[model samples]
Target: MPPFAYRRSAALLALAALLTACGGGSDDDDDVGPATPPGVRPVAGAEGRWDGRTSTGYDVLLTILDTGETWGLYHTGPIIHGAFHGTSGSSDGQLRGSAAMVDYDKGGQVHSSLYGGSYVPQRQLQAGFVFDVFNGSYVAAYERAVTTAALAGSYTGYAGGWPHPLTLTITPDGGLGLTPASTDCLVRGSIGPRPGGRAVYDMRASFTGPNCPLPHGASVAGIAVLDGPRLTITSVAPSLVDFFAFQGHR
Candidate 1:
């Protein structure tokens, strides 16, 4: 080969190698990362407080934590009728989950159901429930910070099937004391702001005294949300057979 021709050929080969290294070769490239799964993309503004009404006409309060754990309640008037807890996920304005619902009106009857819906971040959510569908708007109250002192107060309300009034007191340190107006039942627990600083609290409590509808020493775990003078609490037994839901006003 001639000297100039040989140099041109070498430059051409180097250019071809550079192009191949830059992903200009065949279509089957094993170095590429896997594509994201369909319908599993992260959704912004899906975690917050949602206030809405169910298809059954019951008012609902739903809270979705940053960790995708969900807790909610449905009520008629000021009395909480049922509560649910489950894991949720959202993608492209779509929300889906499966949860266990406990009916306080029916002596804590528990049912499992799957749910799905659509959402507009910080705007609204429309989801289907076991027996009804929910349409709710975002509650700005959820953006407020939660603290033990903010929740320290006396609350009056009703527990499941309890004939008398119930009193729930929270101390400045987040200690909880619950007592029926004229009954021997007593519940003791602790509450505190959730880790992510959202407007919700983590609660763990146990029933005590013989008159308590739940077995003595039965423990429950759940979350709580405060709305102005009203406080709503929903906790579930480890056995899933019994639940405690209280809607009270300070």
Candidate 2:
């Protein structure tokens, strides 16, 4: 059981279906600290207000690179959990099997492991690989991928204009769980188990940004592969939000 598999959830912006770990089963600060690794730790970035008095803050965290080097990533903190793909290496190093990766957190909550990224020695970093994983469609889908050795989960993405903020979830029974604003019903989907301990998933996506509209519903899709995480959304404007590439480990 490898970690970092949950990255697919975020890139798809699979906000609803997967990654309950972000705000579920545990607290945000539960596993953040130096206990996970020697030098990898958290650094508070900025504290700001969302609307008026709603204080929202972000923290910058860093994990070890494949080289055991402390500063392994080019991106800063407030990283979405399980969103790291690869750091540094060359294509040859990866194909030759020398590409390396490790997982660490402020806390040691993450245990299982996997190779979270591909290598690209040219830039002394890994390749920004992404997958298109789809379980169902619309608001109930699953985007699965790897970010680190210690992190892995699923996610459903929603893009475009949404009527309201949406919530997505995956039931223990492998059923899609959706809480959509347009409908009172909880849209559901299902997937079967696969070999090697990897479960098949359906991606659920919604486009419910505060600024989006109603008629122009968000467009969502799933791309699940052994690659990195990415979003191909044609929203108010066509945009690709590759969270893994933008906000990798520190």
Model 1 residue 158 CA deviation in Å: 1.7
Could you tell me how far off, in angstroms, the CA of residue 109 lies in candidate 1 after the best superposition? Answer: 1.4
TM-score of 2: 0.25
| Candidate 2 per-residue lDDT over residues 157-237, each given as its tens digit | 432212233344444454433444344433343332222222122233443434332223343323222113321111111
Worst 10-residue stretch by lDDT in candidate 2? 46-55
Please give the lDDT score at residue 103 for candidate 1.
70
Q: What digit string (tens of lDDT, one per residue) describes model 1 on residues 115-148?
A: 6677777778877663366878887556555677
Measured by lDDT, the strongest candidate is: 1
Q: Model 2, stretches more than 4 Å misplaced?
A: 1-91, 94-125, 128-166, 180-196, 199-219, 223-250
Against the true structure, what is each candidate's TM-score?
Answer: 0.78, 0.25
Please report, in order, the local distance difference test score of every candidate based on alpha carbons.
0.70, 0.24
The clash numbers for all candidates, in the given order, read 0, 52
Model 1, stretches more than 4 Å misplaced?
1-45, 180-183
